[model samples]
Target: MSNETTTADGGVRKKGKLGQRIAYACGNLGQAAFYNAMSTYFIVYVTGCLFSGVDKALAAKLIGVITSLVVIIRIAEIFIDPLLGNLIDNTNTKWGRFRPWQFFGGLISAVLLAVIFSGMFGLVNVNTTLFIVLFVITFVVLDVFYSLRDISYWGMIPALSSDSHERSTYTALGSFTGSIGYNGITVVVIPIVSYFTWTLTGAKGEGQAGWTSFGIIVGLLGILTAWTVAFGTKESTNALRAKAQKNGNPLEAFKALFQNDQLLWVALSYLLYAIANVATTGVLLFLFKFVLDNQAAYSMTGVIALVSGLIMAPLYPILNKRIPRRVLYIVGMTSMIVAYILLGLFSTNMTVVFIALVLFYIPGTLIQMTAILSLTDSIEYGQLKNGKRNEAVTLSVRPMLDKIGGALSNGITGFIAVAAGMTGNATAADMTPSNIHTFEICAFYVPLILIVLSLLVFMFKVKIDEKMHAKIVKELEAKLASGEIVDDEAQTAETVEAIDEEAKTLTE
Candidate 1:
């Protein structure tokens, strides 16, 4: 027999099937694949392949200009992400606010990515100034669509489940699948970009034509993955949106999300972690080539990391039952710090390097998995505290920080490259001993410091531990079951007192 029930909002409520959860989570695979490709390889393409055959000195100058523009675009996202998030929250449609955007956004993103890699500007022999302007404009447009899909996509996590353990399950599955997609690109990108030949010349010459072809394929793959989520999972038809729709000021709703104390702490901690993580990955290619003396090792490292994550993914839900999130965070951060130090100290030893990479990733994945659950818990906290639910706006914190972190990572890596004289010299063969040292310091030590700082912030500032989360969930569920709307003033006062009590308990 089919199970169905009606919520107080007069909308149908039912648990999403396992198949739906798996399919919806699969969307992350494509999203992660596309994002990882761009963040990890796009700069490499611009600096190395795009300018192939051009004068090295001239190309280097142009690359500087491009990198600067890229950084600016990323900074622009800091403002853009929240606004897009607000728009998504305010949006209401028969098909749902998220799936439409996910479908169309992924579709447009594919086309734009293909266009970027198509080398059409080369065909037209566009002037350098005109090409840069057009490329920047195209990239911005592409990113806008990406944000649309991303914000809406992740927003669905809380909307998909109100239960904390369920959120952990979905997030863990998403992270696992997403890692597959991400590593798939990392492992094969080199071969894909060199598999075929065309009239193109320079670094790989006509072989670089494969980039455009690969872009097209990946683009289409993105669309397929998006559809899996769009068609599969069912979003909660909660009364929250109906209540939000009654108030038309999206800006107020957006502001209210940041005002949530728990969410604020979570976002800050996640932002720091994201910055350190992406920044370290940003410099790995350089480290592999110049320091490790094996470009292929970069892909191997990525594959091993992803495989480690896959093995560790199932363990998170099990561990969540036994460990407090605060303890988990501490353990993960401590493990990562130790791994980074070991990797730095024994940089030239292949066995140590491989072992360190594995050790780093296992706990890193655990931390990420737990962070997702914690963030979802904060959604309930916001609702209980603020008398409103803004899933899209609240969840947007992750993507917003992601963009900021990526931009900062790029800037950090770019500076290190320039300082080491690696920027002007494309190939690792030109790297001096001093350059290698600088690379090691920037890639390893800098990220270690950043992560250390992240741990401190999370440990002291973030207060939503397992006990606190349980309290919030119990109170919210009770409030829902009562079917009585408490007065705004009274609700706010009670929320404050309850949260304060939890804080006091945590301290005691």
Candidate 2:
């Protein structure tokens, strides 16, 4: 069956085959698994296992350095991501622009990630300097390649379909699968690491060998999903895209990106939300291990997240039909605020904690879906205003902001772990009231403040809604049909065909 579908407005749109859509969604499965493993637990592995054998003072110093290094590298990536996005935007090949990057970049990064998780094969205990050097190099390279894969994977969404509802379906599916990948790791990591660590070394808790094995598994999953996207999905091409490619200019694209007011507003709001959300989630492991004194209970949080994903992901499209995205965004943020407050007041109560998790996650998923749709729509807003489409560049903002958030979260998590004496052989029994207070301030209060700010920014500044987007689409379609925004290359090809037909008529 053909992948194309007819829209209500009589436009030919590529909705993609169900199989293709599923394949595209699978890209996020591996991506989230790989990313969450690193973003959420890499620090845990480093502080708890990798440096466990070192002297306490020296290990503390090294952890500080590593945390700062992670923050610096991710902050530096802020500059690199846009350039990579521009590169993806300009890329063209027989296999299409985004897939090659998604496949190869995912493959290489997944391997490097396993290397990172390996703790340099126990080199930290043998030669700390060499381990540090190799860690930095491997980490930087892994992040770059992963960003390329992430940017390209998301960038392809706009190309798949122009219909807003269809775009929401694609976004929802990807987000849902991504949730499964991320939370799936959360659910299984403790048990998996514990079992493997025991099997490999007769260790009592998580160890280097176990972490390494888990990393390798996640990496392989990443590779498989990347390949699925590359081979199973398709990119839709058109005159506008062809025209945009011909005149692609990175510098101009950057300028155009900033000029799109709607994009900037949505990006800024989402950035705030991402930083707060990630920072909170990133510290959950530390919370469970130290505050609650039940690291195994951490997996239940993931179970809650999975349930939230199942409900929220499918509900987004349905809710969106009846509610404005702006309103949903408000509701989600408000629910998170309430959850944080609940956690802050009664964190030691496992039942309250679990209930807060449910409240926080269900709405959090809705907010994420809303933000993604807003960002996707802003691409069209930029195109309508600038007369060029830079899907990769625009969508790159999502991952870029995410990295920045992850960077800050890593830094925050590292600092809190150290300050609260939660690192290296420390148990919840070791934590004092003071340590728990510090954790609460960073994990709960700080994020609460940020989420509130994010809500305010979106409510006041972001103007694009369903009605506005539909109007923009109508105007763009009218302009395209009237040749008011014609593709010069496509026009030239048409002119050549006309001339050839005229010559044949004269000969006849």
Candidate 3:
């Protein structure tokens, strides 16, 4: 029997099963694991381990170069990501548009990640120039493929279900599993690296071989989970969806994105939130190792984040029912502000730090889930306003903003480590009071300021709430019934401009 059902507007939507939701959620697990390994730990490995055998001055210079490369490449990808999204939107294949990209992109990026983590097979010690060349090549390819997979993976959310509540459930489940995969890295990396180091080289400390092994293990896990997403999930198909799959000029899709005022506001707000949120991650290991001199306790933060996810992930849909997203966003941001204050005041106390993390994460998880829902909801908003549903293009904004934020974070992290003399072969004993102070300012205070900006933008600029979204959906259904909205590919420039003017006037 067909799982598809026709809506009042005569459009078809697929009803997903529990297993399909679980399978869709699994994609985030692999993606987050793969992403965190690169975003959170790759720099740490480069600064602390990859350059340990090189000359001090040369290593410092190399770190600077590598950091520059990372930031530049990620920034470059911001432009490329939208095109990739359009490509995905235009894709039609036997397997499906999203799944093929998810599978192949994930698989190839995983392999490249493993190879990159292997430090290009120790080429640096033998030939520095060759290592840099290969690093550039591999890293660029890895990032591109990773972006493709990320876009396709997230782009599936709206396609899974158009109902707001069901969409929230999927987003929350993905976030929950994704946090486990992302934060799980922090919890397991030290133990895994330590144990593997001992087993491989009979050493009790971190080594190249250990890091390489960790990469391979993560890669394999990524591949397996991505495969599950491809084989296990289903995409909703209808006349509209089928038409959307037809090839169109990416420029039209890109222009339509700017017409959606709500999407713009959400995108801007999420960009600030992402930068503020991710900027602090790279500094956590340094904080535990250099400031507190307790490397092991770093994992506790991850555990707290995971525990918070366990508690808050399921709570989102419940809380969302009773509270408006704007209110929830404000509450979460306010909690994070308090958490930062506590962290800053009690930097040296592990107990206080752990408490601060708990406070930070519970709300932090809520905020992330809300941001995702906001972004997802904006797709419908854009469709209503622009008369085109560029789901991949609209959703692509999230990851693009993430990469920009992550690049900035990497730059900040690398700069702090080098300036504080916390890089390669440095010990906690070697850190002066001034160095500790620098780390504190960059790690704690900077993100605090960014978080405030994010909250302000969200509170003031973003206006869509549950009530508004329901209204928009109802209007869209009417438009579909009246034949006012048609295939997005057939949307003409004059028609879109007319709708944009009407939308602008309505807002005013």
**Which has the greatest lDDT?**
2
Q: Candidate 3 — which pairs collide?
A: none
Residue-by-residue lDDT tens digits, candidate 2, 213-317: 999999999999999999998898653454467436778668868877778888889998888888889989887878888888899999999889878887888
Estimated TM-score for each candidate: 0.91, 0.93, 0.94
Candidate 3, superposed: residue stretches over 4 Å from native: 4-14, 238-243, 488-508
Pick the winner on lDDT between candidates 1 and 2: 2
Taking every candidate in turn, the Cα RMSD to the unseen true structure, in Å, is 3.4, 7.8, 2.6
Task: In candidate 1, list every pair of residues with a backbone clash.
Answer: none
In order, candidate lDDTs are 0.74, 0.84, 0.83
| Cα error of candidate 1 at position 153, Å | 1.4
Candidate 3, lDDT over the whole model: 0.83
- Scored against the true structure, residue 441 in model 1 reaches a CA lDDT of 82
lDDT of 1 by residue, 240-313 (tens): 34444432356766666666887887788888888878887777777777777777777787788778777777
